[model samples]
Target: MELQQMRYVVAVAETNSFTRAAERCMVVQSALSHQIARLERELGARLFERTSRRVRLTPAGAAFLPAARQCLDAAERAAAEVAAAVGEVRGRLNVGLIPTVAAVDIPSALRDFRRAYPNVRIGLRVGASEELVEQVREGAVEVAFLGLPTTSRPHGVAAHELAHDRLVAVVAPGHPLAGETAVDLHRLSFEVFVDLPAGTAGRVQSDLAFSAAGLSRDVAFEVTNADFLARLVGQGLGIAMLPAAYVRQLSGVTTIEVTDAPARVEYVIWSRAGRTPAATAFLALLDVPAT
Candidate 1:
């Protein structure tokens, strides 16, 4: 089958409307129909089943859809690879970042990337680590900076460890633990904790740590933002377990080292599937070895 025909099939399958697919392909409805019909005849099966209200893919079409999309993606990647070979980086590069990424200087990295590849388009998004990982896996975001567990790795993605920051306990200056150089995990079980909402990287690690210590603290406040959690800790609202990189610089909090704490490891991850030239160029700027 012709490449254009595969493109037409994928467009129709995605839009599920012949007229809309025609518009997307920039071809008349009749030509699109004729080519699809010819493709069906050659393949000896109908790709789509028609209805008055909607168009649906047949079983055979369902089986063929993913392969068709993969072919299209492979073709585009091949073309992009050739362009990249000639030192051209000019396309949209969607990058994802976790809400708490203080250890890495992302702004400086982006500024340098723009200086090197001015033509490349950049899109930045901040999200929870789990959310960002999902976006990267689905190709919605081309690359992501995430806080992954030291022992755990996300499946179906390539990850490079960029930096690691220790998880430390932060308390108000007048709090009982403020004067301590280091505190054990179990020692904080009676204290009220200010923590990230459930499903965040910080929250996940904190939960694991508490569970490992066979202890659970009172989560008096749950905030989605790390800065807000730090603020709460600083105001004497509650003690919090947070990254040392973030809590160390906060004005109103005293950071106490957490013995046996899990390291908040920063990872740069991307889909294992082929990436666009723009994404590759942007990744090179970070100096991370491809995994």
Candidate 2:
């Protein structure tokens, strides 16, 4: 089927309304519906179950949607490659990062990238380091920033280490340990803790550290956001261990050096197979060496 017909089908599937899809595609409703009907006839399958009240994808449509999306993405990448060959970097750049990213100022980097490559479209996804690494591997994300414990490194991806630092203990101002200039895991173990969700890279660092020291600590609160974790500590719910640089950005918490804290390494990772022009340009901006 024609690419235009595929585009119309995708639009209709996404919006679930031919009228809205037409508006999104900048075409008339009848024209968009007619094209989809023509495509369904050619494929010998009804792509959608349309009733007076709603439109839903039929089994055939559900099966066809993924391939249609891949085709559209391929077409876009091909056009981008052509532009890049002519010294124009114009494409979509999907970047992923952890919420506690501190090695690079992401907003400032994006601002500079926009100024340098005005034609390139940029998208950002915030997630855990493990999730972001998987996204990069699957090509859903073109570039990502990650922070993993020093014991582990990014596998199956092209990675460059950005920085390394140990985590620090955070406590409320009135907490017993707040006056301490530095504390070890043994001292912190006696206190309750707030931490990132279990099994996340951020959480793993602290967990591994305590386990290695033959210690067990109670994590009373589990949060997805680091800022929220800090807030919980500030309220004296529990203490937390977070990256030193990240702690400096938050208020209402006292940071004390963790003498036996787990170390973390920040990295920028991309697909080892290849990189899109937009990704390459962005990496160049960061001075990441070519792989």
Candidate 3:
């Protein structure tokens, strides 16, 4: 019924404890419970199953939760839209990006964004390119920065190409291949490697290159973080191939040019349906034209 009541319900459902929910919502336990009870009477369905130890959402509560969240999001968007019309941006900006993002410096960009729109709250999520893309399409993330193989493009979203570059080999200082100025995929494939997990966009670039060259490399370690992968390579665990720009920022590893390396394209993606004002402002900051 009331937005405040819905907020309390969502808070309780998420925390799974009336006491914690009350603390989170900054309301007394009795007050929150009373409001929820009043809401239940109005809706004619109990929204939660409370026990001595824990609280769980009832079937009806589960069904109502999603709609309640949507309502809250819509209301926030409406208020943000009005603010935007008056030349002020105020909204939550949820951004997702791959861990190896290089086209834009995320921390610096966020610093500038915060200074420009202090009222807008910013949230960041780091993930693989595929996961970030899906989050953008699903509206879980308002914008995402992705890096995919040159042969691949993000599907089901509006995207702007940022940059493309070939991957370079990264090896420990004492590794045999570390002294090489440049190497072909076939030559590199002979060595054990540390790489991102199989099927991830980051790993696929090297995999595709090796497969095309009719060579295969053993991935002795698979890690989600690029820094960790580089550390593994630095420790002589294995070698890795990563974006040229990204590799430059790492220490304790030697970077070699790859003559026949796979290239990756960086893209900034957003929902095709529409853009939130905060998202539009952030994209504008990056010089992305309106689409």
Candidate 4:
């Protein structure tokens, strides 16, 4: 089958609609459909189950999708290598970021990268650290900024540690623990806790620490936004443990130490399978060491 047909198959699987895939691929619907049909005939397997209501990948299609995507990635990487040989760095760069970790002067870095590579197009997708890592693996994003646990190394991706900061307890100024220089997590075990949602890096670190100390907390409020969680703490709704950098300057809240807390480490993660030119340029700006 042709490479274009494989692309059509992948696009249709991703969008779940042949028409939408055609739009994305910049091809007419009939031509796209015709090529996919030819591909299926050649392979002697049905790639998709198509109905007027929706398009779904068949077992065969599901099995083939990952390989198809890898083929496309390989092709793109080959092209990028050629462009690099000529000293050109012009392509789309999709970036994933966690809002809290984005406290790192990313805007200034992006501005400088753009000035150096004016022809590169940039797109940013914001999500929790866990979600951003998955997007990078799925090819939905080329690179990402994430908060990672100091003890764990992410599998199947390359990571560069940017900075490290300790987690601290945040509470309203009038709260009972407000005056303490350091708060033992177990002391707040019975108190209401405002926490990041499950699967986020911060939440993972907090849960592990509590579990290791044999402390079970009452997580009454679950939020993805660090700032909003801080506000909840300020209102005396609950106490929260977050990165020091996030809640340090917020009014109406007091930041205290979480004794022996694991440091929250910020990292920029990307796939090792291929490096786009724009990604290379941005990584250089971040001063990433060769891996």
Identify the candidate with maximal lDDT. 2
Q: Please write out the lDDT profile of model 2 over residues 1-291, one tens digit for every residue.
A: 999999999998999999999999999999998999999999999999999999999999999998998898789899999999999999899999998999999999999999999999999999999999998998889999999999899998999999998899999999999899998999999999999999999999999999999999999899998888889999999999999988889999999998888999999999987999999999999999998
User: Hey, what RMSD does candidate 4 come out at?
Assistant: 3.4
Candidate 2 clash figure, as a count: 0
Q: Report the CA-based lDDT of candidate 1 relative to the real structure.
A: 0.84
Query: What is the clash count for each candidate, in the order shown?
Result: 0, 0, 0, 0
- Report the candidate with higher lDDT, 1 versus 4: 4
TM-score of each: 0.71, 0.94, 0.96, 0.80
TM-score leader = 3
Better of 3 and 4 by lDDT: 3
Angstrom error at residue 160, model 3: 0.5
lDDT of 2 at 42: 98
Error of 3 at 240 (Å): 0.8
Better of 1 and 2 by TM-score: 2
TM-score-better candidate, 2 vs 4: 2
**Candidate 4: segments with Cα more than 4 A from true spot:** 121-142, 155-157, 172-182, 198-200, 211-214, 225-228, 231-236, 248-254, 257-261, 271-274
Worst 10 residues of 1 by lDDT: 72-81
> For all the candidates, what are their Cα RMSDs to the real structure?
5.4, 1.7, 1.4, 3.4
Candidate 2, TM-score vs. the true structure?
0.94
Per-residue error at 179 for model 3, in Å?
1.2
Residue 250 of model 1 has an lDDT of: 75
lDDT of 1 at 211: 88
